[model samples]
Target: MLIKGYDDGPLVAGESLLPRPGFWSNYLMAICGNEPGASYVPEWFGDDGADADDLSEVLFDPERWPVFRAPAQGGPGVVVIYRNLLGDYGIDYLLTHPGRSHAQHVASWEGDLSGTGLSWDELIRIADTPATGEGVKDSAARLLLVLPLLTDPDLPDTAPARLTAALSEAGAPQDTASTTAEHLLAQLTRRSQHDPTWESPLSGA
Candidate 1:
């Protein structure tokens, strides 16, 4: 899966007009899925200068998708961090956004494993919580951490008897896991929205 991995971090003016890591290897690492597959990035992305395709189409291409439009022409674009459903594989992709050296927006794509058929905003709308904005985001983050276990393919009888089981597998307590999962799912009830809550990691979880 070619997950968006571009970082919108401040780049020294006039650094390089390249993709996320400014290197091919790093870009490959970011876009490849559970296992690396042979792929050629379009030239417009500034990699090999190979034939290019409209980014939107490439992004929607079912072949490499579920994750990978790689080899994007670089400048400024949105970088979305994504991990595979199994959580073993992850990528940060820089999506090309013309004329914007920095991503106007950034967020995680959880791949809708919640199965409630609710959008992120809908989930948030239905939620009533004392959790702070950052706290909610943290809750959201923890839910994502346990989703893979809940949906694990190899789980024979049942992936997990309950959410707590999955949380325990993730080395998180039941209460903490439940809280975070609630926050993450809160917004999914409503339409997905761009509202983001960001904080310094130093603030501690």
Candidate 2:
């Protein structure tokens, strides 16, 4: 079967889903048998640059969808992050916000195997928890740690601003907590930029 990957972190390749006004409600009603409402919009499904199609349409009525010359699995899968407006805005807020919010946002996207259908508010809450276990910890630990220093609670800062600060600000406090925090922060920075939100403000710091 052809699989699609959607993410809400940032625009990146391999994303199949795109969240819009009412994507979640539609998806739930159509696939998961839940009806959050028909407020979810699948903006990426049309013949746009990303060329995303509704999974249900493809599955129920294959004739309407473009014909794939090769096998579905062999064909390229589209990976999309968050498509719902509420979800997207929530994530954006988390990414741009200061304090613990930045950390949780990074962790959610980092640990997200598939970026589609995520709730922005949930991600922000998760990011705040310093101890969310090893899996989530490894996912975006470095990104989360750098947030505290980079964020200026008084001044609204962009993700880049925070990241830049982290790069410049060196020599954090030397203590057990500090050392562990630094080590985890290092893991996120030293890795490659494959994920969607890596370039976002929260990811860098």
lDDT tens digits by residue: candidate 1, 69-96: 1111222212233333233333332333
| lDDT of model 1, residue 2 | 21
- Best-fitting candidate, measured by lDDT? 1
Instruction: Write candidate 2's Cα lDDT for 36-83 as tens digits.
Output: 332322321112222224443332231222111110121111111222
Model 1: residues with Cα > 4 Å off, grouped in runs: 1-161, 192-205
Look at candidate 2 and tell me the lDDT of residue 89. 22
lDDT value, residue 71 of candidate 1: 14
TM-score against native, each model: 0.21, 0.19
Clashes of each: 28, 30
